[model samples]
Target: MDSFPPALLAFNLLLYLFTYVAATDSLTAQDPYLKDGFSLVSSNGNFELGFFSPGLSRDRYLGIWFKNRRGPTSVWVANRNTPINDSSGVLVMNITTGNLTLYSHDSTAIVWSARLLRKIPNGVLQLLDTGNLVLRDRKDENPLNYSWQSFDYPTDTLLPGMKLGWDLRNNINRRLDAWKNPNDPSPGNLSWRMELHEYPESVMWKGSQEYFRHGPWNGVRVTSRPLGIAPILNFNFVSNEDEVYYQYSVPNKSHTVMVVMNQSNYLRIMYLWSATERQWRLYTSLPRDFCDNYALCGPYGYCDIRVTPSCKCLEGFKPRSPDSWTAGEFADGCERNKLINCGDEVGFAPLNQLKLPDTKRTWVNKSMDLEECKQKCLSNCSCMAYANTNISGSGSGCALWIGDLIDLKLIPDAGQDLYVKMLASELVKRGEVQKTDRLKPKMKISLAVIAPSLGLAILFIGLYIFKKRSTVKDDHEKIEAQDLELPLFDLSLINSATNNFSIDNKLGEGGFGPVYKLDIVFGKHRANGLGAEGQTNIFEALE
Candidate 1:
């Protein structure tokens, strides 16, 4: 090539570098470089990637989100902290060095990059069906050799198949950080993480300080957030002696799900294109009502949304400050009506639709039975409450809380049941037997009346059908003289005639009646079944 000016030569070299990167695996790949652009698509083509500006922010950020989503929401943001000022952001993976980097107008100025511990001999960045953007070595064909993955660092949104804990061996911990605002992709002060310590529980941190806690793994849910435990959001514990990690996934393939913490620290789960509503629907949320705020009613208090006054003191417990409680200030919590003497006569209080307390100062035994858990809690004077850790089985294991029970909520269904340890003297103080008889008899009486009524209905229905069928021959003869003869089609004949009532035939009657109307013969001639005087079945006539 002919010698050129130094500046022009440098510009040409930069152009060649961009062109080469923009060409390699630039289309139909997980991470595609589109000439001057780039896209990250899931393996099953469920999602796509491009430059997105969250909300009203003009700053451009690279993100991957559902392709045909009802609402375009970025699930993962690459340059969240350092957004490009304009639409000129380019993402490319260097083929030789296996380094994936985002660029601004200046080719050498790196905007964001996946800091890899080691270089992959033949690496390629791929977006998996799980919504994880992973860097894999092509030649190795081993999943264990993944150099880096987007799952390790989550923005606000928690996608279907992302882990949320630490792998101490590899130093990878997938954690979620709230966004600065609705439109800004920058990390917010509130961070949500699965604490691998003690046991896996989702912990919310306001900076370095732990603000709220989702209690330890109860085999069903985090005790403090029983509502967060859902079928759509399947929690998983990855451990095998050496290390432990926690993650979640959406079991249904047809369902598009995501959990996002808005700027206000409200975690919301949304579903896409629900069958019942035929639109995107918000399934559930945390801090949904006032009760969700961590320990709104302080120690020894429970939040019951059903009551006019949702916050209430546990049985036999009185508010520390009666004046404050009446004025809607419950930070003083509640004091026991009678102090526990650790006597042999202590009992447990059954609380329904209540989320279990926090687990930070709690004790757990994964193998202890519910009864054993109860006994354990009773033995400890400080243990305020106890619950079965695994509700899936015969309620195996124990979770006992000794400190203040925080973030209690009233969930509709699937709320963890907590047995509050109370002194036997408290039962006498509250007049337990008097209240039990008042409430228990109504439920029993209602069931007793309902069960017999249902049985009587079934018996009456059977007798009526029997009597009618027994007199069918006599009724048929009586009607023959006055009623017209009607052709009764066989089930198979109707099925074959209408092709099993295919949807095509199910709608719109043709000018000649139904589209698949067929002629039927009785004996040797085609029969006109309509009588001169008899009426049609009113139901079919209305149809």
Candidate 2:
């Protein structure tokens, strides 16, 4: 082959270098990323932004994924809903609009575009190691702020450090929506978002209805359960004037973790990549059991998995519909057994190891103590329960719930205590019931020890009476058996009146045997029973 001239060869080498730079480097206003093998890789080489088809899909999408992973793991997709049928796609920064636009098949048709309020003359689109694809002004030195970012519009997976909440100032809600299916990148009905209420909480929705909730943040963690111990993962939640968001991070770089809202089973799952297993192992999942279903036990009721028929009414409450409740249908919930008198004396009944009720109608005071919380709840007729907002250390902050309490669950080890409001009379009755319950075991033990002793005493008296009867030989001492007439009393009736000859009713021990005083009145007659050497003699007399 003939060698090219020096001038022509130099020009050809420059063209190859330009092509190589465009494929791997960030996309600037001047450099457009083409669909034909061109891509952008993060500086740390952890993430890549490119145009590709997901799974066996022939449709192409602009997305970000792990750079050197075994299989394609797309974290964020730009044109997920709209895909290019052919490979003619280009991602470029429009100079006039100062926005990142994706064009598919034709230059006139726009597939998906990200807009910025203020136009930047020198805009640059870059992919970060944390899997965030951002468009920022080239002159800006701060990496924290971005004109537009993929983290603000997450798809199925919630990568580490990505905010999953609202930007109040801009009215932007950042939430995770699951894909339609394994092969499709379209948005699904299942979504996980931070709900904005008096007390905000992270909730998962199945379309318009609530499916599950990771209870409100309680200064430590979400009140529903502990995410995990420290050192492995650190979860942060912030709520203020401008923004409210929840984010989690793995402290150790060796550990790879991601949260995905799976559409197939409608589950929010956290997966940790296990190096030993060479696969993603399930770390945790929400809606863990049947009790995790939102409002499964309805209002004023709680679900305890340890008990049979998990749904149970709270103290002072009864099933709203007894027939329905007995049929295992808890949707009707529960109603107060005794209605509360708002002006009358009232107190709080503590329910322990419980996942706090829904906070739709709630009030919180970060500086108030638990006693203050109780007083506040008591003062408000609508307030049904109160609890310490933070259970760390001695516990501070107050959370009061108004209206009917819903979605209560028994969390056992990782649950908070809720003080439910009750009438003073009900409180006293509950106290007495508890006292009786505590004494039941002791009562059983006493009966076990005393019953045998009483039986032996009766047996010994019977033997003495038999010997006395055998020794009686005088004709006048032995009464004529034919003329003797005595009314026989049922043993059961005698036992009932003397309370089974309880030790409490025992008078004193006589020469014959132990005597029991039975002042039981039968009709117009009073009967007294004496254990005279096992020949229990009953004497009836009018009172």
Candidate 3:
């Protein structure tokens, strides 16, 4: 047999490398263990999770941050409440209790732990490509017997496969809490939880007060924030014999999503990259506009971001205080033009393209049809509105609202049609008044021009005042110093410096001016210590 040359051998090695990469790409959950402080790189090597120290702190923390995430975007944090003071932290599973514990380098301190009541024969923690960290039992390939997992306790980020509701069997409530800051993984003031009070609603809160709500679940999506039901997202509500929990995931299984409660109490969804932009981009955010604030338009009123003022009363209602509304204060909300008569005398107005209101004090019937729901609301005068829970396949369930509407958002494609009850006489009066007002062309034009012109004038005046205040004495001092430090050069001196700035000597012209490279001898170095090359002509300036 003839031996291959060196170049031929190198070519064969390069071919083997490509084949190895291709083979690794197809592997998934094929490994049994990810050792302590070591990570199993994603098949694509786009993400890695082990342990890292954040910022200037020496404390070691176990977290799963994006391998290419823009500047430390940690999706999940383990032991956030207990950060190891040094590199002594080691994550290991105990065989006796079947618990996952964080210990010191010398195995002295148990800094943090995931408590498990039962003992497992053998266990090892594994990091799945989906960014899920699970403690798996070696005896069985099934994950049903895991000792402890990060999905049970979430930090700020909501990954695609994680559940977000209560587990009735174990009485465990899964919720996402915001981090203290970008650098610190401590719990913060903001928290997002799926409330199952009367109806299941996802809400963000700043301490005790509710900040924004995503209405009630209408089977397919949350009625208030229909964007949550986009094609990329799949909301799952499971109440079965074993578990009762709500989980959501991005439809594209290959991609990873993290819906996080940001430090500011805003719900944000970030999508991991594939090839386009190698960074996580913010895909969606709640309270995206002013209208998303809790009860911004008050009772009987609705907030519309499309409008300049963004607050308006319903058709059959008028501002409670005209003066307060004009002054940009709307706490008083709106009052009914006529009282509700509670009988067949009431007429239902179809509020199209709207997010159903908060359902904290509401009722839901899975078997009720639309006609049945309407009759139920009609019978009880307190039922302000009614809508279908599942809006697919001719609709199947009913969600009824009893209290004032709160945190309603208007969406185009995903919103459910809401039927609001109002007095027939009030509706007729409003229609007639609108017809009468439309006939007055002069009044209509005046309102259109005067209001817009006033707004423009105010905007221009505010800009002028800001410019005036910005150019004070203190600001001028900094500008003056910066100008003095930069030497100003004339075109003539620059021309002479490079023989009329010849093409050969010309460097490059940028935003400032053309720069020319000059070669000028300082002094005559005629042997007898004539100060060698004296001082080279090293002066430089921008003209």
Candidate 4:
């Protein structure tokens, strides 16, 4: 063989290093390091792994991207928040433990670590063509048998076969959160998560508040999503007792598609890669209208984006703050026109064909029917509303609300009916009037108790005035008594009314003076104040 020069030998070695990266897939303990210049390719040569700088940023990130691709496309990132300052970073899978770590220059500090739960002997870190970077045993290629995987953790992009939901058993929340900016891959304010409530729904949140909801996943599709099943796209939702998630897969691998929660506009943009166009084409973007915004119409307010002024209070209710509501800020929501008094005085005003309210303060009884749910709401004075949890098959299950109803909107041919608790008088206007005869007995008893109580209340006020005038001893405090509302009271009459302002009659004390009751609780009973213990149930704010 002819003697090769040192320069020619060096060139051949560099060419071999580059070629080796394009062919290799699995990285084991023996081959622990993949340096900055080297890359890891998927078994099918579909995806590539390397340290790359995003956009104009000087900081480098350890990421996996489409093979032969350049900028504007990286699927997943490991050290997104903590970027490597230079290109001297290296990926290392420890020999003793099957742990993957990205290291800075000179292998001094770790930029990121996988922190695998179980150590697998002779384990391999393989980048699958499906874009899942998993740590599994070489003998077991089964995805379920894997000890650790990158699919559990996600970035802005949700790829095919990637789950967007929860793993309750492991407390792993598989959700998509947006990047801080175009260049920065750090988590932003917007997030996409499955709201596993009485009815499991996919909602996008801006911070803690709901920004948008895909509507709940009905049997057909997300109730509000305009997208339909097509030849290229396949949608799936799996919700058992343990885990609940929404996964999308492309049956034809040739068709490229992904859902990106756009950081700039907080829009969940579905994109399909067009080989013809040589770029990603926008399939759809959600929150297409002002009505799509979470709680766009506020509490008990129904929004109709088709209407010019969409925000309008529900029947039997009015805007809590009309001024703010009219100004296009309907967040204050609406309050009842007639406050419900529980029992027979209340009837349900059934609002149909609308998005249901937020379920944070909701109580669910899966076994209860719609009628049973209505009865349960009526029994509890705190319950403000109730709705069917499942509307697919005759609506089985109950969802009861204890507080304000919010984020409701009109979606024609979509959403379930919400039966709001309202006074019978309010319900009458909506033709939902209940039997008023059931309320007559309570009304009669209330009036009989109130008549004598009103006369005693007048007498008690007279005593307080006399006591104030007589007790004023200081020269500066000496004030004339004005004969205004109440009839004059003798000392005997005043003493009889207040029980001599005794400890038994002492209602409570405030900044003005101590308040005394005139047998108010025992109402028109014996002169002796009996059965009145602890603080009186009678709440009086005396002037």
Clashes of each: 1, 0, 1, 0
Q: Give each model a TM-score.
A: 0.67, 0.77, 0.68, 0.73
Q: Which stretches of candidate 1 lie over 4 Å from their true place?
A: 1-36, 68-70, 92-97, 139-143, 196-199, 204-215, 222-248, 264-267, 274-280, 341-347, 429-431, 434-543
Once fitted onto the true fold, the runs of candidate 3 whose alpha carbons sit more than 4 angstroms away are 1-47, 68-70, 226-231, 239-246, 264-267, 341-344, 427-543
Query: Which segments of candidate 4 are over 4 A away from where they belong?
Result: 1-10, 68-71, 195-200, 218-220, 226-232, 239-241, 424-428, 432-543
Encode model 3's per-residue lDDT on 1-543: one tens digit a residue.
999999999999978854453234121223322234454455555555667877776777877776766744677877788887766666665554456767766678877777563566456555666666666666555756766667878888787788887766666778888878766788887887778765677778887888887766666766665554446777777654455566777777666666777774455555555456766666667766777788777777777777768778877778889899888787678877777766558866777777777777788888899999988888888888888878878987887889676555667666788878788787677668867888789788888879988999999999998888787866899999876877555777656657786887778888999766654343432211112233332332111
Candidate with the greatest lDDT versus the true structure: 2
User: Model 3 reaches what TM-score against the true structure?
Assistant: 0.68
Best by TM-score: 2
Per-residue lDDT tens digits for candidate 2, residues 1-543, read 999999999999988975676446477767755564577787777788788888788888888877656532678888889988888888778765568878876677899988564676777777777888777788884755678888888988898999999999878899999988878989999999998987889999999999998888777788778445334788889999999999899888988888888899999888777778766777888888889999999999999988879999998999999999999999889998789877978999999888888989999888999988988988899889999988889999998998999999988777888899998999999999989999999999998999999899999999998877777744534565523654566899778777899998898898999888775665655566552232344442521
- Cα lDDT of candidate 3 equals 0.70
**How far off is residue 454 in model 4, in Å?**
64
Cα lDDT, all candidates:
0.70, 0.83, 0.70, 0.79
RMSD of each: 29.7, 13.0, 36.3, 23.7
- Per-residue lDDT value at 225 in model 1: 54
Query: Per-residue lDDT of 176-237 in model 4, one digit per residue for the tens?
Result: 88888878888999999998876687899999978887765555456565434244777778
Clashing pairs in 2: none
Candidate 1, 1-543: lDDT as tens digits: 887999999999988876554333223234345323545556576766667777788888888777766563678898898988877787777666667788887666688888775776556676677777777777554656678777777887777666677767777767878887878878888777876644456777777766666666666665555454455667766654544656667677777777776656445454455656655677766545667666778888878777867789877788989999999998888888877765557888877667777666778788889889988988888888888877886678787888666666666675778888777777675666668878897989888889989899999999999999979977888889655545455789667645677665454576776544333343443322231123344223222
Which residue pairs show backbone clashes in model 4? none
Rank candidates by lDDT, best first: 2, 4, 1, 3
Worst 10 residues of 2 by lDDT: 531-540
Q: Find the 10 residues in a row with the least total lDDT in model 3.
A: 524-533
